[model samples]
Target: MTVVAADAAVSQVDAAAAAASTRPRCSTEDMLQLLQDYDCWVFDLDGTIWRGNEVIEGVLEALELLRKLGKKVLFMTNNSMKSRGSYLDKCLQVGLPAHVDDIYCSSYSAAAYLDSIGFDRSKKAYVVGERGIMQELAAVGIESFGGPDDNEKRASFSSEMLHDTQVGAVVCGVDPNLSYYKVQYASMCLLLNPGCLFIATNTDARGHFTPNLEWAGAGATVGAIKGVVERDPIVTGKPSPFLMQDIAAKHNVQPAKSIMVGDRLDTDILWGLNTGMATLLVMTGVTDEQLLVAQRGSSNGVKPHFVMDSFGDLRRVAQQALQQQK
Candidate 1:
């Protein structure tokens, strides 16, 4: 789908900052300078700009500033729990701005992966995740396995089904009702046939879903299955170079000029760094200051070229780079 940045993104910062101030530091002028060069930006939302119910301070201002500089902004998140429409509402609720074409979530990536790989959903495959994940499956023509046409049962997911020829693959993610029985069924299928593929939505460790933080993300569960099945599953999420390719294609932007921004080392930052794209690690979520600081010793320069306390300062780097050219 086409993703665009929101107009509210700029104005939404101050109020959010007042509500959340226990954050890092930034320089306004520096951010303004950085904005001069880069026209496109890919942002990670959760920790970099907001945490749960509260939006990060100055995030809206940062976004607005980017708009002022004529930069193209997009939100790229690895969490595939919520659908694009839900995310549209999410931006409105939090005061962030981006067009529907500017939002690229892991679900989009997963859907694109299925599309590129030519996954035929005519067969049966048990689902254990959120609606966003299922939506991606449907985009690829992957329907539920329990339909009358397939003669599959809703609870057909089982060790027996895994061993049976009818079962094709196992797709897992964050489902509150996930149970040992469900896992047993998924594992049974993978274990039954080493050729079956396993796919996961993301690898986020933890998210402030609500009143309290929750267990890390879809990674551990997929990892556990990999350990048991002794077969590697194909990861259909961020940092795979595939997502960037899809985004670039849709936006018609040059990957060489675009930059990816976020607060996590594993998902947001590394996704860009590993794929030969410029990345910025905003100290708003998952990886803290200490960890980001300690992580700087990489001799391979595999680390991000720049790090900022928040998205608010992104413009500074760009502005400064532009000045040097003058």
Candidate 2:
């Protein structure tokens, strides 16, 4: 994850506009052809696969159908609330067979970025998130400090309080128990400490993982610290493009032979477009039909190559594809 300018992101949006102009929405024949074309399918978890505690009705069958057709399946998520293991657990709990290696989240991406950069484990990261951030870092042998612990709870901080000198980075994620103290301490690490890295799992404003409970997302915590520190973070989640590259490198996924399915237009669709992969927008989570129509011809945001009413629709297509393969 590296800090990128607003212009860099805006430029991606503009590029997407030009590329999308020549493409038409998928027809029934196009849908079946798409299923036949891709050998790998990457799906967003929160809305595409499951919503809250319940699994999206036909997605489980869809995944099975895809696997039966010898397709590789992977889960890509921007929700940094949990580690990859947790996500895998959730997938299995809801009846999807998920292997640990098949799950990817912003947390793991951040860890991989740090690992690639040879981050000094000797220096601790001042965390402004939940235990998941710490857990992922630990899995990568990176040390972190200050998240959801009793000592971090209700801690008093003033301008006079001494900053932790050993803190070399300010890592932010989804902190449900976010306090002013977390922001203050993280800001101090970034502003006062020399050579401090500012990292964010994702910059999503809110979470839609669970229905009816709109939780403040990791972006909120990152934004709070960014406001205090007057800096931009190296976002390691969706829309980063680096993440998609990493995915391809790790899983040997060919861009032309893989597809990304998600409910969010900005993050999910943008990631796919930016990384040269096919994008599918599902109407199960964030983006609705009205918004999709309004943005259809806009040059300011990313557009999907195909749009489906739900992943269940994709499931039906995959089912047909499987039958034809027999």
lDDT of 1 by residue, 1-326 (tens): 00112223323454544344343344555355445446788888777667666777777876776666567888877777776767878998888766777887776666667668776655556665667766666766766432122223234433334345556667766555555555656777777755566776675656645423545566656666666777766666665667777777788887667778886777777788766667777755665444544456444323565667566555455444445645
Each model's TM-score? Answer: 0.78, 0.89
Off by over 4 Å in 2: 1-25, 150-152, 155-159
Expressed as tens digits, the lDDT of each residue in 1-326 for candidate 2 is 11212223334554554465445446679888887788889999887787778777788988899889888999999877689999888888888998898998988878877887899989988877777778999998988878887234554534356678889888888888888777778887898889999999888876674664556788789889888888899988887877766777778999889899998888889888878889998766776544565678676856798876667766777777877888
TM-score of 1: 0.78
Off by over 4 Å in 1: 1-30, 145-164, 211-214, 298-302, 313-326
**For model 2, what is the alpha-carbon lDDT of residue 304?**
91
